[model samples]
Target: MKNILNNVVSLIVVMIVLLLIIPLSPFFLDVMIILNIAVSLIILLVSMNIKEALEFSIFPSLLLITTLYRIGINISSTRSILSNSGTAGQVIQSMGDFVLQGNVVVGVIIFLIIVLVQFLVITKGAERVAEVAARFTLDAMPGKQMAIDADLGSGLITEDEAKERRYKIQKEADFYGSMDGATKIVKGDATMSLIITAVNFLGGCVIGMVQGTMGFTEVLQVYSIATIGDGLVSQIPALLISTATGMIVTRAVAEDSLNIDVTRQFGAQPKAIMIAGGVLAILIAIPGMPKFQLAVIALTMMLGGWYLLRRMEEFSRVPEPAMAPGGGMSPTDIEQMQMEDEENFKDINSVYDLLSVEPIEMEFGYSLIPLVDEASGGRMIDRIVIFRRQYAQEMGLVIPSIRLRDSSSLNTNQYVIKIKGEEVAKGEILVDYYLALEPPNLEKEIDGIDTIEPAYGIPSKWITVDKKEMAEIYGYTVIDPLSVMLTHLSETVKKHAHELLNRPEVVRLVENMKRQAPELVEELIPQLISYGNFQKILTNLLKEGIPIKDMETIMETIVDSSMTVRDLDSITENIRVALKRTITRKFCEGNSMRVVTLDAELEKTIITSLTNGDHGVYLALSPEVMQGVITQMTEEVRKFQELGQVPIILTSQVVRVHFYRLVEQFFPDVFVLSFNEISNNIQIQAVGNIAV
Candidate 1:
C-alpha cells in the first residue's frame, strides 16, 4: 500500500510539472534539461564501466540524457541562429538567448541533444574500457609466455613466487578478473551470453535515456556500479556496497561460535566459504536478466555471499561444549578460527561424534553373557559385544581415528575345553569332561618357545605368551628338576594321574611313582598328557587323510548312545529337512499341478467369460483346478506306451545297447530309473500332444 501511494504521488507530481510548471516556466525547464543531460553524458563517458557495457543499466540512462540534450541544443540553437547570422559565435549567442527564453519545445529539444552526445560517448568509451579490462586481467594471470616455471625449478624465483603459483594457477582456471580485482566465475554459455548481452545493451540505452531525461540521476547512481556517462558516480556506490557487504558478513558470522564449530566439524575450509561468497558477489554485478534491475545486482550478490558464509559455518562443528572434569563447567575457550585457512588442510574429521554406549550380551560356550572386560594386545576382533554395539548408530566417521581399541581386561564369558575318551568319537558331540592334568605351555604360539629361558634373561613380554617363562619369572617352586624320577610324588604328577584315576590300576601305578621320585615326577608329568598335542596330532592326521573315524566311532559307542548327541546328527537332520523343503519348493515354484478335476469343466467356465465362440486370453485355472489337471497329467504319462503317450510310461524303461564281449547287448531288462527315460519319451513331438 505504501509503495502504491508513493508511486501515485510521484506520477501526479510529474504530471503537474509537465502541465503547469513546464509550460509557465520554460526557461527553467530548458536550464534543467541542459544541466541534467550534460552531467549524465560526462559520467557515462568517464566512468569506464563494470568491465562489460551492461545494457539497460546506469549507462543507458546516462546515454539517453546525452542524446536528448544534443538533439535539443541543435534544434533550439539552429532555430535562433538561422533566424539571423551563420558564424559560430553568432549561433552560440542566439542559441543561448533562445534557450533562456520561455520556449518549452526548445527546452525539450535541448534535452534531446545532450542525451545523444552522452549516449555516443558512453558506448564508445565503455566498449574500449571492457576490452582493456579483459586484456589486462588475462595478461596478468597468464601462465604462458613466462619463464617462471623453469625459474622455480632452477630455484631462481623466491619462496613467494612458489607459493603464489598455486593460487595463480587456480585463478587462471576458475575465473575472470576485473580492474577492481573482482573475480567472476565462467558460468553462462555462449548462446545465453549473447541473448542477455543484447537485451541488456538495448535496455541500458533506452532506460539510461529515460532516467536521464526524467532527472533520476540519484536513482541511477544508487543502483548502478558504474555508468556510461560519468565514471565517478559509480565509485561511491560500488565502494559503499562493498563496505556494506563486508560489514554484513562480519555481523552474521563473527560471533556465532556454534555456526563456526559446525563448519569445522564438517571439515569446511575458509577458501570454500570465500569462493562461495565471491561467486555470489560476482553474480550481483552480472544481472543480464531481461526487464530486471541489472543495476541493483551488486547489492544482492554481497548479501548472498554473507548468507552462504553463515550457513557453511553452521554445518562445520558440534555446537555443544564437552563436559569438564570435577563435575563442573570447563574453563575452555570457544574455539575460534581465523578467517584464513591453514596449510595441508584436507577438511575431514573421523569419529565425528559418539552417539551412545550400552551393555550388550554375547553368546558364549554355554550361556549368554555380558562382557565385563577383554584383552588382546595389537589384535582387532570386532564382534557382537564390541564396538558393533557402540556403532549401532553411525559413527559418521569421515576420516579414520588415530586411536585404536584398547584390550587390557580379561572378561571372556567362558573358557571351554572338550575331553575325549581313549578312543575319540567319530562325530563331534558335547559331553561331561573328566578332569585332565596337562601342561599348558606346549601350545605352539608364534612367540611360544618350548624351552624356558632363564628368569633373569627373559623379558616380561615373554611371560604373557609362554607359561614356562611366566613360571620362571614368578620364581615358583613348581619347577623342580628332580620331579622327573617320581611317579606321583609332586602336585604335577598327582594332577596328571587324575584323568587315569577313573581306573584302579592306573591310580596304583601313579601312587608308586609318588613314593619313588617325589621331586622329579611332579615336574615331568605335565609334558606327557596335554590335549594340545593330541589336537595337533588329530589335525595333522585329518589333513594327511588318516583314518581317525574308527577311534571316534568306538568312543561314541562307549557313552550311552541316548546320552551321546552329536552336533552333526542334528545338523544332518536339519540338512535333510532342508533338502526335503527344497524339493517341495521346486514343485511348488512353477505351473505344475496335480489333476483332480476334468479340464472340460474348466474350459466351460473360461468360455463363459468371453463372448460365444469368440476367443481372448483366459486365465483358465484356479489353484484347485490346476492341481486336478497336474494329477491327470501324471496319470496320463503313466498310462502311455503300450507306447501311447501320457509321458512317463512312454519312457518308463530306457534300454540302450550295452557292449558285452565286443557285441551289442540290447538287453531290455537293463534300465536306469531316471529322467533319461523321459528324454526317450519321444522328443516332445514339438506339437501340443505331449502337454500344453
Candidate 2:
C-alpha cells in the first residue's frame, strides 16, 4: 500500500510536466492552481518545523518539482485566457480582481514587485549561501575524516557510529551541492513568470481587438485584469517557496523548531520585556498618537511583562525539598526514591565494572582538570592523539588509549601515571607557570622556584608567564605544564610498551602480517616457533626499545634461527644480531657510535658470576662488587650527560646480558649493547670506560 501511494505521487509529478502541452478546462486549471498553493504551504511549514537541514534533505529535489508544477499551471491558464476569451479559472480571476480593485496599473505593479523580491532578494541570497556551504563542506572533509578516524582509533567511538557519522557528512555535502544548483531553477522560474504574464496581456489584447468584440480601452481593461490575476496567483506560491528555500539554507541547527527557538530566545530576559513595556507606555502618552488604540496595546504589553516577571520570581523562590525527622526523607516518597537510586547505582557500579582496567591510566589532581576539559580549550586529548600516531610511526607500537580521570585525594599540583593498574611515575606541575631549564652558558640565574624537569630530571625552575620571553631570550628552554606532563607520559609509555603488548595484540599483529606475507607466517607459526614464543621475542625486543616495524626481517630471522636455537634468550640475541644495522643506527650519532666499554676485569668478574640453569642465565655477584660497579658506572654516565649525549655501554656478547641485569636497576635510562649488535660499517668512539 505504501509503495502504491508513492507511485501515485510519482505519477502526479509526471502529469504536472505533461500539462505544459495538454490544454485543460477552467475547472481543472483552478484545481491545479489550488494544489500548487497547498504544496507551497506544506513546504514552508515543514521547512519552519525542521530542527536541522538534513531532516528535509529531499528539499532540493522538491524545489525543482514544485517549480515545474507552478510553470505548468501558468502555461495552462495563459492558454485558456488567450483562446477562451479571458475566461480562465475563478481562482486566478478572483485574485486579479481583489489585488487590482478595478486598478490595472496597481495590480501590475504589485505582481512585478513580488517577482522582483523572489528573484533578487530571496532566491539570490539563498543561492549564495548554498554555494558557500557546499564549498566549505567539501574543503573540511579531509580534516573531518581524520578526526573521525582518530576517534575510532582511540576507542572513543565504535566502528558503527563512526561509519554513520561519515555517511552523514557526505550526505550533507551532497545536499548543499544540490541546493546550490536548485536555487538557479527558482530564479529561472521567476524570470519565466514575468515573460508569461507579458505575453498573456499583449496577446490577449491582440486577439480581442482582431475579433472586434470590444474597443481598445475595454480590451485593455479586460485582458490586463486576467493577465495580472494569473501572474499574481502563480507568483504568490512561487514567493512562498522561495522564502522556504531561504529559510532552510540559512537555518542553524537547534534543539527546537523555529517558532520555539524564537520564543525562548526573545523571552529569556523578563527585564528586557519590562523595558519594552515602559517604552510602549511612554509612546501611548504622546499627544499626537491615537490615544485609545495605543493605550490598549500598552496595557497588553505591561500585562505580559508583569506575568513574565512574576513567573520568574516564583520559579526562583521554589524551595528545596525539606528532610523529614532524623535527617531522612518521609517513609513513602523517600524510601521509593532511595530504592530507585540504589537500583540505578547497582546497574552501573557492579562487580563487572571492576574486571577491566585500561592498559595506560593517568590520574590528575582536581586543579588540573582544566587541562583535559575540551570546553575550556584544554588540548591534552589532542596532544595524546598526536602522541599515539608518533609512537606508532617511530617505535612501531600501538599504545592503548590512556584513560584520564581526576583524583581529589591528590594534591592540587600532583599527577600520577599508572601502567596496568600500578602507579609507575608521579610529578608536580604548577598550572599557571612555565618550567625554564637553564643553559650552561647563562650569565645569571633567573629568580624562581627551583625544581627538576619531570620527564628527564634535569634541573629547572618554574617561571611566571611574564618572564617567559626573558627566559627564552637568555637561551633557556621553556615548556608549558601540559607539554611537560605529556612528554613525561609519552616517555613512560615508550619505556614500558612491552607490558602493553599481550597475546591478543600479538594475534592481531599476526593476522595483519598474514595479509601481506601469508607464506612466511603460515610456515613459521606452530611449526618453527609457537605463537607464545613469537610474542615473547617481540616483547623482548620492545623491552629494549627496538622497533619491530620491520616485521619481514624479524620473521625471516626467526624462521632461519628457531630450528636450532630453542632458548628464548639466545633466539632474541640472535635476532638482535640480525638487526645490527637498525640497532647501530638507533644508538649511533652519524658515522661515529660513541660508547663506554666495560673494563676487562669488571667484564670477567660479571661473566664469572653468571650461571646457566633450566630457567635461563642468572647473575649472582657479591653485594660489595655490585655496589662498586654501580658507583663507577654512575660516574661514567654523568660524564656522557655533561657532554649532552645519551650513555651507551658496550660489552662482549657473553657478558652483555649479565652486565645489563646488574646495572639496569640503578640506571634504567642507560642503553646497554652487545658487541654483535653493532654494525662493522660504523666507526666506534669509546668515550669512557666503566671500571671498578
How many collisions per candidate? 85, 0
lDDT of 1: 0.30
What does candidate 1's lDDT look like per residue over 1-692, in tens digits? Answer: 98978698456445434432222223543453345444544453333222222211233232333333333333332222222221113323344344535443454355335443333343233334444544655674533323354344334677588667656544432322231122110111112222332333344345545544434443233112111111111222222222222222122123334345455543445455446546555555554643244334544554555666677688776666565676655555222223123321334342333432211111122211212122322112222212222321222111111112222232231221112212111111111111111233423332321333122111212222235554544442232221111111121211222232223333333344567654433533343322333333323222211222232222222222324443222222222222332322322224331211223344354334333234322243355644554555445434432232212211111111101100112221111111221212222221111221
lDDT of 2 by residue, 29-142 (tens): 999999889999999999899988899999998998999899899989999999988889899889888998998888888888989999999989988988888898899787
List the RMSD of every prediction in angstroms.
33.3, 6.6
- Among all windows of 10 consecutive residues in model 1, the one with the lowest summed lDDT is 655-664
Q: Looking at candidate 1, what is the lDDT of residue 337?
A: 24
**Winning model by TM-score:** 2
Model 2 spans > 4 angstroms off: 1-95, 105-147, 154-161, 173-234, 250-356, 443-449, 514-532, 580-592, 598-608, 621-629, 675-684
